[model samples]
Target: MQNDFWQKMWASGVVGFHQPEVNAYLKAHWHKLLTTDHKAMAGEVLVPLSGKSLDMLWLKEQGHDILAVELSLKALEEFIEENHLHRRFSIQDLVHERFCGYELEAMRLFCGDFFHLTREDCQDVVAVYDRAALVALPPEMRADYAKHLLEILPPDTPMLLIALDYDQSLRNGPPFAVSEQEIHTLYGEHYQIEKVQEDKFERKGVETVESTYLLNFREN
Candidate 1:
């Protein structure tokens, strides 16, 4: 998605994608997706294209460090204030729009392009929660998005991906229709894919199917 598109969305408050509560799927299945270190688990979880989702807070409650990359600073500020964590935060860097710790939680929010992140910036990331990122991109950008995740994140990183399947003819989207087959085509070689759960529902009178996928990025 273009930076302007995202900026406008935040400025205009057109964020239907921003849920008021923690995602139920994430609440239910988070532990199953943690990275294993031969015998014990290690490393932080990455939330790419993360737009101040309360899911990050929930993840922190699970005793995991949270690293989130979002395009909008407004969303980040709102997140801090809304959650009553502003006191624990300080301006670590204004130019980068980076901050550390929130409500005494080990949380970091980087207000920048997700594509610009590097291994040095996120080497500890061993897992990802993609509740909104993949489905937010258009078709042309999806393949490259997958490639970037592979480039910056650790090889064999575990990911819990939530995607929506709907008739494209009915709506033009930031919440686009991405099928299970499309996910395979994009990340199949790099990751092992499994459909863990799914739910069907209606949004704006359009029937939609939302599915959760467990992605294990394969090692070399």
Candidate 2:
């Protein structure tokens, strides 16, 4: 998706994609991505294309550090303002021309293009929680998004991914439909994919299927 499209969405306040609460799928199935002993995982959890989702705060409350990236500064600012987080967070330099970083006690938010992030920038990320990123992209961009993730993340990094599937002919999408086969085709070569759950629901009278996946790096 183009940066301007997202900027316009924020500018116009047409952000239906913004969930009012932390996603239920994240709440219900996040434990599956944890270790057997049930301890909180080490390192920061990366949230790509993060758009001021409350899930980051929820993840921090669970004793995980968060590293989130978004393209819109307006959205990030709204996050801090809406959550009353401005008092606790500080602005910082990302050492990049196009990116700005904000840091709280346990979370970092970068306002910039996610694709501009380098592997070194993500060296501390241990896992991923992708509730919105993958499904937001068009088909042509999805491959690039997945490829970029593989390039930047450490080997064997586990991800909790939530995707939506629906008949595209029925509706135009920013929350695009991504099927099971496409998920496999994108990540099957490198990640051990597990279908954790599937739910069917109606959105705007259109039947939608939402899927959750636990993805761990394939063993060498």
Candidate 3:
């Protein structure tokens, strides 16, 4: 999908993939995936395709720096304004427009295509949080999305990934159905993948399964 696809999703308030709170899976497994090393103080965590997720704010409060990237400027603005964080930001244009959180500089949001990100932009990223990003893409884009994650982050970067498995016949999706097998195919070579937990639930009357994985990148 093009950038306008997401821009329109935000503009039209059709962000069903957008969660109102920090994702439950992240909250449950974040400590296990990310360690509290003093070295973590020097690096930031990466959140790709992040659409004004409150989880970024939550992570910032946990004392790690955050680098969140999104396609929609409207979503970014709403995120800051809605959270009453508007007063703390200053902007710069760095390929992607950069929104720097002033008080602690704990949060930095880059607004543009996530695929445009380079290794330098994420060189200090020690961890990743993929609540909505992976499952948000259609099947065709998922491989490239996986590749970009591998290319951008340093080796062995810990990741918490949440994905869905369901009948594609049931729905058309930005929140697409991504099987465990697909997850293995896409990221298995680069990451030591583990299925940590899963839950079965219904949304809009369709049966769905959500799985969470812990991805530890192996030596390249």
Candidate 4:
């Protein structure tokens, strides 16, 4: 894994990818995967590769338990401190020696590698909110990540996976290009897949790198 890229991104505070507002797509479309037969359903959700973002709070507000996994301890610490949350947990003794969960208690953020944390650790996730998990990794790692998640998920669990589809050469990525076929290739065998959303994007700001693609998966 290219650990340096993410470590440097956090170290340098280059968090342009961290959206301040709750993701609209997440708000609107996450339920589609959670509901049974399109009827509104409520259950715990897992956010793999979650950074210090407010989306977990938003999920809690909607009455669902949220489990977010991240690799950076610094990012997780800042998230709890900035929110002024007053809860803390110790998992290092039980798991990663220093990895912990929520400081306020609504969510759990594992401050360690996602690969190291088993899917059994996130067992309650009836639905997965993969807003940025797959796209964050390089190609080789993405395949393993997807398979590992699917294997650990409860049978028949559904997932909402978001992937970017655009020319990789057009823009280098951490928001990497994960084409529709790749999503299918990675997850289609174990889940019922569909296109939940797709949008087109043209490059915008000078520093703003860009690409476009969207896909969701429902485990059968």
Candidate 5:
């Protein structure tokens, strides 16, 4: 999907992919990959390509500061507005619009392009939760995304990445199809990659064929 296509989707309120509830895969599997007897996340989490999902609320309840990066102000607006949140707005260098205290304990939201968020913007992230980031971009931009993420997050940070794969000819995508090889190619330099889960799914509502992958990118 191109920039104009996504910009139009936001402009026209066409975010059908935005789920109202926390992702079940995230709920069930995220902690498994993030925390074990050996190690656990120590500080705030960075959620890239986050579009005001209820996952932020859930994460906050677990005592994690939610640092979310989003592209559309409309998506952020819908997230807070639809939740009937009394959000306080402000402008910061990275935050185009911010919804203060939405989930308690500084759920800082940056409503702008993820690429524009600098390394300084992600200073305290001990964990990176990518429920929706990599596969959201076109094939060419994947490397840049991985590089920027590793540059920002502290080394040895645990990362939970959820990706979708399938034949693109089967459907048009905003949730673009990305394969396991591509995942390794983009992120292998800075992270030890592993495939934690996979599933075949029917996209009955949307015109798409999809399979999901749960990936662990242990920062090297």
Candidate 6:
């Protein structure tokens, strides 16, 4: 999606995709991705394409630091204001030219394109929670999204990814359909993919299936 497209989505309040509460899949399976010791990962949890998600707060409550990226400044501002997080965070501008960043106690949000993020920027990220990032892109862009993630994240880093699959003829998407085969095609060479859960439901009379995957880098 174009930058303006998302900016307009926030501006016009056409943000049905934004969930009001923390995601159930995260609450259920987040522990499955953790180390054997049952502790949070060592560094920040990366949330790409993050849009004012309450999941960040939930993760913070679980003792994990957060590193989230979004293209819309309005979304980030709303997140801070709505959550009353402004009282706890010390906001600041990032040194980079393409991105503006805001920092709070244990969380940081970068406002910019996800593709513009570099390995150095994510060096400290130990795990990733991709509730909306992968499925938000078009088919042509998903490969690049996966590749960039592989490049930036450290080996053995785990990710909890949620995706939707349905007939494209029924609807256009920011929530695109990504099947299990496509998920493997995207990450199979480098990551061990596990379909942790699958749920089928009807949306507007159309059958839609949501799948969750736990991905870990394959040992080289």
Say which candidate scores most in TM-score: 6
Model 1 lDDT tens row, 59-152 = 7777777888888888887888888775755534433433322223577777778887788767887688999899999999999998888888
Q: Compared with the true structure, what per-residue lDDT tens digits does model 6 show for residues 65-133?
A: 899999998999999999987677676656676689788788888999898888888877888999999
| Candidate 4: residue 149 Cα off by (Å) | 0.8
Scanning candidate 6 in windows of ten residues, the lowest lDDT window is: 34-43
Considering summed lDDT, which 10 consecutive residues are worst modelled in model 4? 205-214
Could you tell me which residue pairs clash in candidate 5? Answer: none
**Candidate 1 structure lDDT:** 0.80
Ten residues in sequence with the least summed lDDT for candidate 5 = 93-102
Over 183-214, each residue of candidate 2 has an lDDT whose tens digit, in order, gives 99999999889998999999877899999998
Off by over 4 Å in 1: 35-42, 88-91, 94-105
lDDT, candidate 5, equals 0.68
TM-score of each: 0.90, 0.94, 0.89, 0.83, 0.82, 0.94
Write candidate 3's Cα lDDT for 16-114 as tens digits. 777898888888888877653223533688988888899988888777788888888788778877987746666443343333222226677777778
All candidates in order of lDDT, best leading: 2, 6, 1, 3, 4, 5
Q: Which residues of candidate 6, in runs, are more than 4 Å off?
A: 36-40
Backbone-clash count (model 4): 2
Among the numbered candidates, top lDDT falls to: 2
The candidate with the higher TM-score, 1 or 6, is: 6
The lDDT values for all models are 0.80, 0.87, 0.79, 0.69, 0.68, 0.86
TM-score-sorted candidate list, best first: 6, 2, 1, 3, 4, 5
For candidate 4, the TM-score is: 0.83
Candidate 5 runs further than 4 Å off: 37-42, 87-104, 204-220
Q: Give candidate 2's error at residue 166 in angstroms.
A: 0.6
